[model samples]
Target: MTLALAGGALAQDAQKGGTLRIVGTADLDHFDPTSGALVTTNNFLRATQRTLISYHASTDEEERIRPVGDLATEVPQPTNGGLTYTFHLREGAMWNTPGGARQITSTDFERGVKRMCNPALGSAMLTYFVSLIDGMDTFCDGFAEVEPTVEAMKAYIEENDISGITQPDDLTVDITLSETAGDFIYMVSLPTSAPAPIEVLDYMPDGPEYRENFIASGPYTPVDYVPDASLTLARNPAWSAEADPLRAANVDNIEITFGIQPDAAIQQLQAGDADMVYDITIPPAILSLLTATADDKVMTMSAGRTAFLFINTVSDNNGGALKDLRVRQALNYAIDKTALVQQMGGPAMAQPQSGIFGAGVLGYHDFDLYPSEGDAGDPEKARALLAEAGYPDGITLKMPYRNQNNQPEIAQTIQAAMAEAGITLELTPVTASDYYSKFMTNPRNTEEGAWDIAPVGWAPDWVGGAARSVFQPQFTFDGRHQTYNYTDYNNPEANEVAKQAINATTPEEAARLWAQVDELVMADAPVVPYYSEQVVLYRGPAVENFQPYALGGQGDWTNVWLNR
Candidate 1:
């Protein structure tokens, strides 16, 4: 089915005054917008926070994904040779407070941008904006020198105003970028860029106090929150539908129950106990049953997430085998992607991916620099390369994989394929909570050769013109290491191409350059691009206006309402 039609299904007459129930396995990582990076957290934030710009919840894929003004009067056009953006804040956009709603101002927006650089918050998205915004990197550097206290944070923010952001009046905010970025407007639409009141600075960022003292500027406000237990959101009494154009505010309350597994969530959905399965995809075991019995309720689409295996070249494990380019390339050739797709629950769940860019992002092209035999892989070629790399007999490698989300089965499938090419893999399982934050992202683990191969995944930070979003954080390391860039791989030529792509005047020109960079990075084989996935979600029968959001690749909560 076309995405437009599927999105249109949700727009039947909207009903109001029902509690929407949501269930998920894991709790949110952070309630503060600046600190959270997970998409699930972003989904919750959508109801409580308002960015300067945001996409309209629509049925048309392009219109639904494109950025438009939320707090701002409209999406601003870049001036000063694409180096400057001027935003006029919309009047009457207010923050929900204890006494009454307070007007949201340009200072609030500036405060939000400054909070991202706070060392205590440790925002994963800071890297995307640090280099582009004028004097932002310097501000961040100065912030790192201070103690992580509320007093110190307040002093830092008060002493140093971002030179680029200037507010001449209460409503006007002018921003100048260090570099020309065509995608700067899109970056502002992210949750990290959501405005917060200066009063929030009284509490420590990301500390317990901050979460407790959370304020809302959107349609809903968090009334009660217990981590790993439950979260209850009610309509912000101060919020007016006339002021905000994006959210319908159809449901009166949103109740999210934590610690429910995907299978259990599915059961709850089928039994009409739950309205939606939060962020978890439908489990593979019951996919066919739901497809036949409840096809209209199912929604599937490709998000920007790409899953791959990171080959640690810096590690000296297995006689520093991965350090050789031929060995790395052989590892890429060794895996049968076709089999890997089936292990991930058929093409509906995942398709073989050859390059870094996924399907949804611009500049994404289909090409495999390293050719495989009908996506089954060339074991013979892999064996030949292994012999050439001085590992004719066999090479024993240690691999780590996440225990959740059918990853263990995918790891086994890769292990079997690698065995055919004389590569023995020892698999280590890590829990979902610690996999990315503690294990894979820990540079100490890579330096100590804890594991040679680790399965990892990434989704574009934003939707369109996201070539820089995909390549910069994962592939290139300037000086400071990105959390997800575990290998610490840097290529000057590839980096230069990526820069050109970012600076390209037209989208077509940028896409060509990005595709070129993808080919260059793939030749290095720092990672094995296994598969890109299309998530499958199921909504309760009573749920209506369940438009599939392109960013989260799931039903948009802001657009959904209860039919009953």
Candidate 2:
């Protein structure tokens, strides 16, 4: 009933394919993995094109997942409180160029993780993400008082008496944390886990060259990378066919052009000029066109991402109207998620999200687990809450938003809902670039309070219960937590619980603790809890075996085929 794959089937099946051209809206400021602050962009570069410990694709109900032999031969074994991992280097793994010059080794991983943790690198990644390891927090925090020089960082590592990490051999690494954390393996499974060559790194001049020459031991190797413009990757010929399809790339070469001048990239796809559009949020007009006119060319999938309206707690009005828990609760009840999703083709075309982590993620908690505090279309209750908060009938608030067309539409829907309960809204829309450069760059400025409320969104980096990391006291970008705590939300108890969740040893235990934190956040209502984002994708007809998941984008491109 089934045909077995022929020997050298992968290579035999390979047709020395045409270059797959992927166009998108944004380009990496730097190609270094640690430099990424957003999830979708980071995962696109890390998951399909690069190799690491684990990979995930889109989800229907279950998390469609795949992971190749990255730097590990098997599931990591834990000693004390961290990991002791051994990677049996697949001899075939090499850089994209010939002569197998980029062959992977144990030493590469040592250098990579060390570089990731090094304070001198000034990577935001090392701070919050890697702190699950015992000594990493101290190393990341060491940069605070004194200049974190290379010698100082190296000496700090050399002198640490922690049981968290050890490089026992060139290919083996061991870690012991402060406590036995449940997601220990998942922590190491991050993009940070992928190793970099110390040799090439030795030549970096503490500048952009560090990003340009960023190497890969995964499926593709960087050839040329232009910041805010384009990135090109060629296949690693030495990459074995037997490697995990989850982490491999099938195409011979890949070209990703960025900052594609809004709507230009979509035009290319409509003209059949691109293999795919990786991360650009397609506009509704283009989405409708794809469905009605180019149905054959569009492939849609659900992504594990969430989008919501965040209220700044530090606002001059103490988060303005949103400061009132009842008002915040009323806003959550006012929006029609079903209708909003229908217009954007959200839940149907992309993964429908309600909870923070989205469905199928390992540690996700059901919204029902906590008492529902917001308006569920109860006009009477909404009016009662608003009245209790002493809001007058003529209250108006200006909510600033990034100019995603759907966002304004969603805001209007909320406006209409609130209108029914006697409230008016002045929906303020601005360009995405301006929105980020202004309000998001610094939320604490005196003038920043001009905007009373706005929609905020987040996409997680991994599948672990650490999804709660976003709620950690406040969200942090780079080393400065104050800027992103736009809500200026401060709860010592919630912050403490977030730390506990990070170090919790089991999902049951972590969930129990995080549940408390989630309840606290939902109750605070700094931002009205809204729907999660769904990633909608369009695949070309020739592309086959395109399984989608949250963490991995472009699916498992390694086994995909272009029908010749």
Candidate 3:
């Protein structure tokens, strides 16, 4: 869907040579592309790094999303029964180096994949590639056994190579997958798959040294960066506009300042102090004012992001109350998604979601297993189920939620609704940074019954055919646990269907199988899917040609030029 703008469009021509200033509430979790999973980090990486394939940063909705080649000459067609892919690197693609610029080769691409398996790095997206690439799982397992040091990491990479990837020449790279993946090309577009220079192997991935001494292979290079402070991007002298088709590089420089709240960032944008708020959703309170005053600058776009509450089925909180399916179903029925939507700033900000997959993702359908009345929830039915599950006198549940954004407000709304169904929710507020990394994902926290339910959100790693993006990471647990699979849930029936869907020849068939998987998961009720959110981005008057990318869920920094 197109971003809904409040005012008239700006001048069409892209004017060059100005510094684009950006402000945001949170700092990037990591600058190392392989280790970071957050969208903000991806936005930062898009400016300073190039992937083999990338989405075009276009003003047109459809053309903007179609994946195109960046470092490669073009999107490769699959060979060898859809199990192999061959990529031809662009002729003039170069990496910014200390001496000068050096040609980026197929070896750099292989190095990028190997970095993903670094144990100390803890790449969240590794699970997506491990099984898909032949011998990758074995590589990761071996890497895990080694000491987490630069010497060990370097030796590991030098000794072994992924059996599936072969660099026939400096420009040609071939990849073979363990199974057929129709959307495998989409995975290469992600930041995790971006090429890394061999020089970076000397420094630990995701460590302080790597973050500071980062090299660039994209249109822009990071000239300066501070962990929680600010970052400055300047044009890469070695980068050729002809080799890359995705980014326009209209702006001469980009300045991103972190730790600015949404309200403050909006004020800066209105006062002409900032060009845009990088990846920060406008607060609902200010969204109304902007809609009336400067509608054209306000952007409300559909993002493939879903907000849900994970029920701790494995945790023995409240004497294993959540272990009962009736109780889990009761929790689902008790949440008033309609009220939750209102609290999150009306229909413009979010739509009530019934399943794990949000709209725009493949396999997403309008089917609610709980069948609430107008999505307002059925508290009476929930109480009956609770009673059936041996909680006739009601139950108490501990919930932890991020303090930032509208999560606190949403939690309060859920608390009010659950109370009506004889469930009292104890809310514990946590900072946005520590919420997921420190508290929710910690196994000790789960074992000690620290929380019974927690507010969480997920966005597909890439844009198209997102069945594996949603299911494998969040639902099914094969041999290893996925980072976002907070509940440690597994269903054999759903897993079997997901495997079939992954191997489906056509998009239509995959979508059908994914829809069935959604039905099965919703029936199990491991998590309460509440709302699919829309991102609201505010741009200053000077910001021109502000087109939002689906993967970044924010305006493309490379395309927009400062008119001022």
Candidate topping lDDT: 3
Q: What TM-score would you give candidate 3 relative to the actual structure?
A: 0.95
TM-score of each: 0.94, 0.78, 0.95
TM-score of 1: 0.94
Taking all chains together, the TM-score of candidate 2 against the true structure is 0.78
The alpha-carbon deviation from the true structure for residue 20 of candidate 1, after best TM-score superposition, in angstroms, is 1.1
Candidates ranked by lDDT: 3, 1, 2
lDDT: worst 10-residue window of model 3: 2-11
Q: Which ranges of candidate 1 are over 4 A from the true structure?
A: 1-12
**Residue by residue across 1-564, what tens digits does model 2's lDDT show?**
332221113434544465677776655433565444455555445532333366444333343433334546666555432544344545555554333356566555555555565544434345444555666566545534434554555555444433355557645656556555555555556665556654444433134655555555566666777765777777655556555434545577778887664367777765667757665777777787777775865555444456666655456563366666777666555544555556566555543234445543444566632223332344555666777777746356667776644566777876776676666667877765456545564545424576666766665555545454455424433344433466446666766776687667676777777767766666666555456555666755456445554454444444455553
Give the runs in model 3 whose Cα sits over 4 Å from its true position: 1-12
In model 1, the clashing pairs are 10-545
Question: How far is 506's C-alpha from truth in model 3 (Å)?
Answer: 2.6
Lowest-sum lDDT 10-residue window in model 2: 2-11
Instruction: Give the alpha-carbon lDDT of every model.
Output: 0.83, 0.55, 0.85
* Clash count, one per candidate: 1, 14, 4
